[model samples]
Target: MSRRPHQIAILGTGYVGLGTAALLAHLGHHVTGIDVDVCKIEQLQRAEIPIYEPGLEKLLLSNTSQLTWTTDFSAVQQADTIFICVGTPPSADGTPDLQFLQTAVASLAPYLGRKQQIIVNKSTVPIGTGDLVVRLLEDLAPEFDASVHYVVSNPEFLREGSALEDSLYPDRIVLGGLDTALDHMISVYAPLIEQSFTPPASAPRPERYTRPAVVRTTLQSAEMIKYAANAFLALKVSFANEIAGLCEHVGADIEEVTTGIGLDSRIGHRFLQAGLGWGGSCFGKDTQGLISAGREHAYAMPILQAAIDVNARQRQMVINKLLRHLRTMKGKRIGVLGMAFKPNTDDLRDAPAYTLIQRLAELGAVVTAHDPVAMARAEREWSHLKYSSAVNAAQVFQRADAVIIATEWDEYRQLDWEALVATMRRPLIIDSRNLLRHPLTAQVEQVGRELKGTIGAAL
Candidate 1:
């Protein structure tokens, strides 16, 4: 945290690593990014970003003077602060596989102790990973003086689509480890903690944005905070979906119910919109990781498991609605709108749309899907699902048997639904995201409403 600008090295170039590099560079820190992907590093070297994230390219390109990308580990020795941003993908049992983390740290070990270093863990890891990293550093680099290096956990809470905005203006920043290690990170995030940096025009600060607080804790507690926050958000979405199912049975409007409850100060209107269940890198992995931790302690995490169950069934809600109307999926040409897990990201990891598409294909339905950003990645990754792909939104609507709104993109909401329905073979619209405020003459089938009420309809 030198005021005159300090050199920092980031060990991964994924969303979190690259975004942190850009954010830090914006604050006048020189950042060097190291990664194993040859193509990705080459892209960065040419001022290109491999992934599709809004404003990330602009931010990185604009601050070229402060950034560097390389595949060399020797470059890390020049920086006093190094951040481990490698991936921790889940294993079969939901425990985070630390293979990538181990490799990065091992490569990093041989070069440490050359200077006074503050090594920060920015990867989403299991609760006790800090201690494990500390052990690895000592064991792998026994020749280096351990006193010159310090390990700390500084977890990131960046959401994919709005990562730039979220990082620029976050709610809080957590730094966990020994008290001695706390000051170094606190100083590192001083600009963000104080909200003193000049805002980027592309992502100006919101009028009501709050300054971030730097929360200090032990290593495991800091790690747990990352998991707990994502788990609770996942639970909230599932809770709303759970209630949406109940609303259909009780003849209540879900939007009305959610709005009513959201007015309460305690229950703010953030993740309460009833639609498809949660999907992304964080929620499922973190929740399952927490449950796996529970298993280690011999305590069954009934609530989290229930949240997961409720979320899984939400996919069925769309299927059940299709069955209720079409009676069978055999030979039907179903057009699905929106395929990404959510909008503004190409990441299809655990997307709710894929599960629905797979189910439709299994029942012998001819499916064609469209998304604003995720279509290319989806075409490459989801070819086995055997569904047709559409880049033009109108192609999805043309001669389609039915349309299911999967990913809530703003452009999907602005389509002329009345005109588009006329082109479809059957004008059935399954509004999964609670999109389309206007009704479609009883032909459009919206989820969580008008689906069930009396036992006669249930039967």
Candidate 2:
């Protein structure tokens, strides 16, 4: 591990890039976050964060002197290490679109200085993308010597809401590069690897992680690790939902079933809660990418395909439950709570609520949705749905025939059930995330249950 600091330039200021920039700066490295979005760069310059991640604002504020926000690609020429953290969204065929990644590499070609630099890919891309990048660099910079640049795969595993904490104290750090590139990456992340950095007073240390492990492998293997990890997690959630469906038929509680199964050493409790299924920037795309990769090699991943199929069905299952209770969605006013993919973030990419809202609209149902931090994004992306700016939970339920809990935000868990019940036209509640705990007068239907019950009687 090199004790000396290095100049790091991170491309894109979305969740992964900004978190990495903040963490690198906090580790005493001079970091410059580069993005094409002027608004995002201006926001960071003003000490304002563009995304919702716990403790990120504090991390950015404390390390502002060490961080630089810029839109210029020339900054890459001065950086000792360049991190490509752009988004690789899914294409029409479900394969990851590498246009952003390719464009970033091409943009850096003209600015490649004489100094040696390492380009670390922090984006979750398909396997062999590192090789593709290397080839592209070779073709683009034919005039420059090959020794001036090295490509490495360093995928990010940071969760949206807890990104800062995860970046600071990750379960493990993985690096996929050649022998020449490994030393530099290790030097850049040495403080994190050795657990030598002092934790900020504002962000407490995670009790579970005393020291993080490092996994070194080939670039292709490291790329697969990112996809495999996310795909397995998606499988776990889908498995839970499958069991949840059986639990409903057998009149068993999914919570108790998951607890019992998760107690076994082979099975863990993480991602086992049965609800509306996973939605975010990672799981769906990665799973689809894995499947697409399998197909490219003439192999079929039936289990992974099933997991994806189950996840899609779970969304329709929520709509099915609503249909069963409401009899007809036509002319019914339904309230949807928590529009974001998951709690603690405003990201709405691939959210299950989108399917529910679209299906409800197609049925001629009057839909009104609300989220703590995602309303503006939802209103912008999904302007068709009616949005409420009401602060009270009861206000969201006002004049609604039924209310469906979409994302499990903590505030939704503490809602005054009785008050919300009074505001609704039909006093019906569909708990998609299984977040409700209190007894209520409204009729309630949740995951793993066929029969509807009043909140007081159900509890």
Q: Pick the candidate with the highest lDDT.
A: 2
Compute each candidate's TM-score over C-alphas. 0.95, 0.96
Model 1 — TM-score against the truth? Answer: 0.95
Cα lDDT tens digits, model 2, 1-459, are: 678999999998998998899899999999999998999899988988888877888888999899999999989888989999999999999999999999988887777777888989999999999999889988886434567688999999988888877888899999998877888999999998988888977677877678788899999999999999999999999999999989889999898889999999898899999999999989999999999999999999999999999999999998888888889999999888988899888999999888888888889888777888987777778876544445555677989999999999988877767766887889888898888765477677889854434445333
Regions more than 4 Å wrong, model 1: 142-144, 450-459
Q: Which lDDT values do the candidates have, in the order given?
A: 0.87, 0.87
Q: Residue 247 lDDT in model 2? A: 89
Q: How accurate is candidate 1 locally (lDDT)?
A: 0.87
Model 1 / residue 190 / CA error / Å: 1.6
> What's the C-alpha lDDT at position 401 in model 1?
81
Candidate 2 versus the native: TM-score? Answer: 0.96
Candidate that would win on TM-score:
2
